[model samples]
Target: MTLVIGLVVHRSHHRLFQEAARTLTGVRLEWVDYEAEDEIRARTAGLLDRQRLDGLLLGPVPYARCRDLLPPDLPVTVTRSAGLDLALAWCRALARGWPATPVSIDTFDQETVDEVAAALDLDRERIACLPFDPDQPVAEIVEFHRRFLDRFGGRYVISVRTGVVAAFAGAVPVLSGLAGLGTIRAELHELALRSQSKRASERRFAAGVFLIAKPERSANLDRARIGLMNMLLNTPEYADGWIEDRGRRGVIVFAHQALFEAVTHNWVSLPVLAQAQDTLGVRVVAGFGVGPSARTCVALAERAANRAEQDDSPGAYLIEESGVMIGPMGPAGHPLHFTYRAHGAGIERLAERVGLSPATLSRLAAVERGLDGQAVSPSDLAGSLGITDPSGRRLIRKLSESGLVIPEGSAQVNRKGRPSRLYRLGIGAALAAGATAPAGPGDAAGGDGGRDGDGPVDGGRRDG
Candidate 1:
């Protein structure tokens, strides 16, 4: 699928951004031009409403300007000049016989101004640094630069902000503080990767194969197939070709893995199927499977369907490629004992006790179940979560901090090199320590394992 990204730019740099976007492949870039920062705020609701956009790029303004305004789930990248770009621009100006003294520079913070001065080996006093708020008006920045030029007698200006550059009006030789093509391309590449990662995390793959027991003379197999297909088509996550008939006695349906997950959380799609079963006076048995590949899903689903057909009761059954069985879902699609169902509430409570959101808790539970109680490395967790390894590491760190998990051992995931550390579920310990405040005495222990008030609180070893 072509990844579509939104590029929000100021009126001034529309051409530049458009040219850059034209060079990208495997991605569609949509440009949304706004006259001012407020315009962006005004249009945020509309921008977010565009469901087709996979990510967003904010131009001119720093991400700080509107980061809080955008949807938290949408990946965003802000165009800003890197330090190397600033250094190069300064070098170019100086090589062109521009005086280094009395240089007026516009930047986002004082720290950057100091870094620029240090990088250029210029006296700090000679560099008139004018700091601007990320959300401030361009006119204010222009006025600040004008005052700096007058007071410091600067003959040259370096500005990364698009708004500040527009106010130049030929008053002084202006050097662009914006990042060069190479840097911009690198940032875009990073953003694209993030967008792809998000999409991967959201993608769900599952398929189900069904077999109908020979029914009374009034029921029709062809009509049942049509009804099943129609039911699947009505759901947003499933579509055409997602369902098909295997034979007069069998049928198949493809869907996102999330469908089964939601069923445990009270989604009533299963009940609709039960109603159909009752109306048709036919016993329907289905087998569901979730896998990374279509072939694997179909194979597992078929195996499950066969198992269901052989069973005495008509229900849904899920079989893992590893041969794990979890079902016997009744006509209403209620699984008697699904792993997710068993751990879901525990995870919710754990999340609350550890100050984590339910979403994170759910993801953690998924990882734990996938590992089958085995210790998992950060990389393994990252793969399961469809996120970067670093993100997985960060999440593991948070879980450890919450006393919900403990480091266990290390294992080599690759052919060569030292093994990576592993962690196991410490839910029992977490529950035991649930009464303790998050900021327990161990907060100042400095990785020293000696701070022990009681049970699980002391179990957090630095390398346990």
Candidate 2:
């Protein structure tokens, strides 16, 4: 599939970005250029509405302008100028016989500025820095440079912001510190990889098992099973699913994870469960599972179905190969709960050290397993836990402080804001080393042994 990446850029830098991405194959760059920052919102909205974008690439200015308009799940990468860009800007100032020292620099981090200054042996004290703040108005940023210039005489200004250079009206020399082609290309490639990974995840094999509650002796069990199969086959949402009888009392559907996500509304609710109860005049429960293979998926589904059967009402549950379980998903369901099997003493101590429940740690372990060594952003972890993005960020901080997660760079997901920092969850490895031994075979890992209250407060309605 051709990945469509929405490029939200200022008209001035549009050509540069296009050139950087010229060599990319199997990807289409949909340009959304704006003459002014204010035009970003409308243009971005139009692009999103008109095209099915696989990912997004924009500068910090454009991201700040239209962050709220982006979809949560869309892959985004906010391109930033590297230190090389800053050095190049300094070179330009020297070329023009303009003193590079005592200049005010905007957007680049202070560390980056200091590094460049030290490498060039420039006086750090003479340089004024205004770090990037997405919430800071462009006017305020312009005012910062003007104030710094007024207070301490400077040679020229360096800025990554699009309009800042022009805002000066040539009153003071302002050299553009925009990201270099190499940096933009790197971010573009990363965004593409992330988009591809997401697409692949959606296509992973998934299985669902629907079981009818034990009927009266006189009731025809085979007939009810047949009716359930017919109901699933006739449903438009299940068209992609291969439906068949699983046992005398159950039916199973096999399909890609994307099909199940659509049918179950991302596991928030299962209208099919309710529909079956109403249509067949019998209680029905469902278990959906995602795993590496068909057999594993079927096993997980059966376990999830068993869990759903324990509930009093017709409901559904989801179980992933990672050992993450989300359940009781009917109209009467409560807030989503991430339940896991109790790990050994090592996990308990580790959880205590990290200030999280052992169950939460277990769930993190499961999430790490599912990642298969892939790095994830805090938002991604939050989605797995069915929690808010802010909560996810907080959780990451907590884990980071305890050395439970290793920083793995960052990803610019579908926002014009800061890139989401990525990390490799260390909990899985931590468990492997800390765990005394694996759980016994007789021990039911799928049972609701441990319940972590860290799940979404509003149930699993939040997109995962």
Candidate 3:
């Protein structure tokens, strides 16, 4: 299938994005060009209504403008100017005979600015930076540049915001620090890969095991099972699924992962469990598993269902092939738990020490195990966790500060743009160390009061 990618670009960057998109094969680019940020909402809405996009690629400005309009499942990539772009901009300033020091830069993070300065052997203290804030008004950003220029007597302004350049009105030299062609092309390629991966994942086999939580008696068990199977067969959400009797008290449904995702609301909740409880007068617990094969999926689903049955209430749990577990997904469900199979206490203690939730640590541990000691980029981690790329980067920083990850060079997934730094998770080793070490003073206090069971752990909410 030819992937349709929606490109939400400003008029100034449209040509560059188009040029980058030319390199992509087996994909069609749908342009939603806007002159101003305010126009993004209408233009993006029009494009989405008119075309079905497999993925979306847009700048931070357009993303901030119309993030609410984007479909929750769409693969969206927000392109940002990397440190290389900033370095090139500095090179241009040098060629123009402008002093690099006493320069104000906007949009790029302070870390990038510092890195660039360090690499170029320039004074970091003199380089004023206003990092990108999606909520900051363009006028406020303009004023920030003006104030910095007036106070520091800066030689020039380097900005990623196209509007800021014209706003300057020839008052100062504003070098456009937009993402270069290389960065745009790399992002486009990444988005295309993501779209293809998403499509393939949707087609993968998934299984669900629904068990009667409290069967009345052996005499009525078969009746209850049959009724549950009937309900599943009648469910429009399960229309495409293959429903059958799994055991005396359990019913199984086999379907594509996409069907189950919709039925379970992306694994956040299980409305069918509640329906069975209300209508059948018997509480039902469900477990869903996604895997590459039918047999593996069923085995995982049965294990997940057993885990859910241990809970006091009717709820659902999901176990992916990668070993990530999420559970208790009903109306009265607690915060989602991304739990380790057996290393629960160690994860909790490590999470407390690092000032992170055990659930987040558990998910990271699962990701690490799946990698089998291979390093991963923050973007890859983000995709695995259903989070935005920036959030993944922040998580990486936190893990780095806690010494829970080791930097392992970088990998350039595409031919252009800056390569992504890779990190190997130290979680398994950290868990082993925490297990053998004597309990510290904090450990005596129960260390965040997190338990080692399949109980709830905080901080599993997906980022917007």
Clashes of each: 0, 6, 0
Q: Which stretches in model 3 have alpha-carbon errors above 4 Å? A: 45-54, 67-74, 93-103, 117-128, 143-156, 169-173, 212-224, 247-249, 277-283, 307-313, 321-324, 331-464
TM-score per candidate: 0.49, 0.70, 0.61
Q: 1-464 in candidate 3: lDDT tens per residue?
A: 34668998889788899899877875656799888788989999988875667899998888988999998989999999999999999999999898988898999999999998999999888888999898898899999888988888997899998789879866788998899999899999999999999988887899999999866544588877876775664343453456677879998887789877777777888877766776677889999898888999999999999999899888889999999999778844222222332353576668788877655666567566545555678887776655678888988998999999999777555566876787878998888876755544343321223222222221222110
RMSD of each: 22.5, 20.3, 21.4
Q: Please report the TM-score between candidate 2 and the true structure.
A: 0.70
lDDT of 2 by residue, 278-374 (tens): 6677888999899999999999999999999898898899999999998778844222222234353666678788998765565576556545556
Better of 2 and 3 by TM-score: 2
lDDT of 2 at 367: 59
> Whose lDDT is higher: candidate 1's or candidate 3's?
3
Q: Which lDDT values do the candidates have, in the order given?
A: 0.61, 0.77, 0.77
Residue 464, model 1: lDDT of 13
Residue pairs with backbone atoms closer than 3 Å in model 3 (clashes): none
Best by TM-score: 2
The lowest-lDDT stretch of 10 consecutive residues in candidate 3 is: 455-464
